[model samples]
Target chain A: MDVGPERNSLLAYARNWLVGLRSGELGVLPIIGGLLLTAVVFQSLNDNYLTPGNLVNLVSQGAAISTIAMGLVLVLLIGEIDLSVGYVSGVAAVILAQMLLPDGSDLPTGFALLAAVAAGMSIGALHGLLITKLKMPSFVVTLAGLLAWNGVVLMIIGSQGSIIIQDRAVVSLSGSYLTPDVAWAFFGILMVAYSISLVLARRNRMSRNLAVEPAALLLLRIVGLALVAGTVVSVANLSRGIPFVVVLITVLYVVLNYVLTNTRFGVWVYSIGGSIEAARRAGINTDRVRIYVFMIASSMAAIGGIILASRLRSVDSNVGGGSLLLYSIAAAVIGGTSLFGGRGSARSAILGALVIASIDNGLGLLGLGSGQKFTITGLVLLAAVAVDSLSRYGRIQAGRS
Target chain B: MTDAPLLELRGVSKNFGAVQALKDVDMTINPGEIVALVGDNGSGKSTLVKSVAGIHQVSSGAILLNGEPFAIRSPRDSADLGIQVVYQDLALADNLDVVENMFLGREQTNKLGKLDHNGMECRALEVLDQLAVTTIRSVRQPVASLSGGQRQSVAVSKAVMWSAKIVLLDEPTAALGVEQTRHVLDLVLRLGQQGLGVVLISHNLHDVFEVADRIVALRLGQKVAELDRRTATQTEVVEAITFGRVSSVPGQSGATTS
Candidate 1:
């Protein structure tokens, strides 16, 4: 339908779908297009919307929610949902805040962070136990988790309505920025790593007599990645350099992406999501895998919570409240991660979160109220899920999924 | 190859609360032999196979593997005992490729603990090619794209790839076409000829007669008869399955509980 010129051809693009849309392939283009559309609309309306300072702020704000959504991708992949992640993060923040209360017995930043993460893992393990061992529906268990964890947050944050984080190490995590030279060097290294990994993977497949992409295609891939990375770094260096939160999110994105795609545990997660009975028949420890997934989700929530507190320089009742949960979920869906599971990757979280943050940042620049932002964001989330369902149905109808 | 049976079930009985799903079912599967398990719907054929695959724990049974009693409390235990199963619905994840499905639980990893994708891809190709399952377009393509028979082949190939001592196929040809069924039957024969024990569970009498060396019939949670294919007729096997009438076949086990 998008028949254009050869140089900018949609027909060429459709033909080049290594995995086609009909097969329910989650292409990055659609989400990127949405982002571009938002940028154009917002920049035209407001002068400051697309400025470097604003863009850096947008990344920092979205980093926390994006990390949680990254974990949600795994949960969703295995056909489970964790409604408690937002509150789980809130609980994580409060724990860290209390541990660093400066009451003479206040622990150092490193130990406090570790303690918070452990708590997150334990909470996830508990949720997994309820779901797997008791044979309870994940929806019910996680719904209950949402309520109970929120109660935990409320109780923990009692008396004092908010706790200001005074530890320099804690506050500076999301507040700091990479120097301009470091940002450029970091981008260079990232591009090089990307290129090398692609080459190595292609070589690996080829050595096994499996099909490999052409050399030209591989080169083009590197070029594309370099272009994107270079543009972001250049723009970021124009402001107070790249935010530390951006670096943290990017590193995790790569690491988690690899974990989801290239490990035995990762394959098991996908299999369990695809078909639990089948995974069991295949002799996979489905319960163990489920448990691990929950733990990972909670740990990610803890990280997100810590990042948010660092960015704000304080922990409050709204650490994971308001649109945090909604944004985390919407980010995943908006980035083309299937709610039904067995699809999507870590990139979905990063891109989806960015898209969401961009919209929020753009609307705020136009003096939009929280009411309008919530409504628009909700509609966007709905649209994403609807699109996911339609594509899934198409794949099913085509007998390819 | 040897005198002793590779797998033997003695006085096996399984109960699901008030209902008895398998009652004192005794069976032997020797290497290089095809044992076709036959029964009408709800006749404990599935239950017996599932129990062997450790999907359900038997209430009372002595399952002997190479003359040693083994406990199969879970599918993992069954797998560790060199038992592989191609379930009735072909428990292959549609989202995964043939290589991935074949090595789902028992994935090969490199020294660094990352997946050895290259090694796995090679091995999957070797097994599929060894089975002569040439209908698949590509092993890299997800099983979802494969036809019913192709998916079935991948499932069967998965069982064989692991060098399983005994392969249990539950209704392998149920959803297949005529040609596909023949292909599966041929593969079953090949597996047995390759010195592996094959238990083919199906209700199709014709399919049973094609490649099975021995036919074991179940009716209402009990073994009605075990017949040698050389000596038993289709009518006799069907009668045993539908009505629990043990035939006067020469190699009949005479375990008629009814």
Candidate 2:
């Protein structure tokens, strides 16, 4: 009943959101709500849970899994799952460790990193080819990849126990932090970039006579982003500043979000995810898109593995084994990336990773065992999936009516 | 009718190992004309449409565009020649918004390789407006939220974009309700009036008679009759489909109504 002038107000925004809720368009609200609720509960259980130092540590701990989760979002978008991401990361970590071995080839750290990433990408491409060309399901192919890549890691390590990373740059990836000054400067740059993008997008929309968001709403969003960035930078700077791995993860998130939201390739990816037949009919190269997404997923997983290795200062047979794969997938799904695909974002990885990390951090502070952690995480994963399915069902019912 | 046909299929035949799906089919689609392709079950009407749309390579015969013979080896090739097909399923990504779906594969990008969202939205609006589609509330709304008729309109508009000169719609109104079917039939007529060669493949004689300028009937993998709407009767077209141009009662050609 209330339309027109009130449309530009925050009340209108809330009203629209309510309307969206009724229509079953539950965007990121659940994840954000879960995140806030978890943070409160954890902080209450452990007085140090929300401390700046612990929060910073939680971010660094989450970086590796979050990076892999971002990649998982891509694969999941196409209604496919990559089961071998853990082992793929393991293969890269092994390669990195071998390259930096004391009496070994002594390759440059940069080249070694590239080589590790390349290996991960190559494996991804192989998986993609098998899935697309041979018409095999991604689940089976990646499952086989999981086992095979694990074997490759074992073959490379060869009972050497664990290789300590002596390379300074490699060790610094997760172990070191940015200085306060550098962190502040980075935040400044981020704000400027965000502002410029917003302005440009508005201008572009206006020029083409496409509907632009109300200027007030636009400003509100920009200011909101700035505030969040400022708070994060300030909080991290309170201690040793943001860790390099945290920065790395943030950069990955930004770049990936840009690619997914701003590019033609991104459109094609979502289209294929939404309906492969529709994408094909629209003349998209679905095969190429699938192959490329797999490559990206594996490469990011490898990068995550590298970060994990850096955090531990070593690469061992157990580097990517255990519940790492499950955690990464849970992060993506819990962050709101739909298992049915075509409905997620790169930011989902970050939010989901933070949630998982909070649980781990809280449990660790409480002296809980790995069994408890797994159980709680598995429960959380199930709840997230249930929410996803319920929302989808609601959407379908609403559409039909 | 005076200009060269936009698309022409000559002696087209397609076989599936032991089964011949299409046999020596000849058809022409001219600009500014709506040709209704009427067929019964297993009538090879789909095969004929697919052959022209390059979904199936004809086992024999040639396809011409603007009176020039061209090889249509794949769907891409057909699309490249400005021939677009709106399949029975509609082939629309239900999750994507109207503009996104409209520009899915052929998305425009800026210099930085970012999707030109504004440009795409503008173009999509233009296309929809040209087709006089006003039922859709927002271009940003996902296709899943659309009514059946609205979805059909979006599919038609998408095909008409990218400078498409010919559009093949396979059973566009098959899944629609009465009102929705009427809306789709109106859209089909508008498409023909816009000077694009329109092919309406349908089972409903009412729809076929309403919008089609000419009627093409297929029966048992062959074109049984091609009749001009101005001169042909529905009974004649029905008879052609059921009996395949051969009157069982030899002397009752003009008088057989039952």
| lDDT tens readout by residue for model 1, B54-113 | 878899988999888998988778988999888878888888888999998889998888
What Cα-based lDDT does every candidate model obtain? 0.87, 0.89
The TM-score of candidate 2 is 0.94
TM-scores of all candidate predictions against the true structure: 0.90, 0.94
Docking class of 1: medium
Interface RMSD of 1: 1.3
CAPRI quality band, candidate 2: medium
In the range B1-258, model 2's lDDT, one tens digit per residue, is 436688888988898886777777889988889999998898889998888888889999899988999989899899889988888898999889999998888889878787888888888999999999888989998898899999999999998887789999999999999999988999998999999999999999989999999998887677889999988999998898888852222233573432
**Candidate 2 — which pairs collide?**
none
Cα lDDT for residue B179, candidate 2? 93
Task: Report the lDDT tens digits of candidate 1 across residue range A1-401.
Answer: 22234335434554657557646665787698889999999999998988999998998889998999999999999999999999999999999999998899968889999999999999999999999999998889988998898889889999899999998998889889999899988998898888889988998887777876666566678898889888888898999889988888888988898898889999999998788888987768899999999999999999999998888888887778889988999999889888887888899999999999999998888899999999998888887888888888878877876
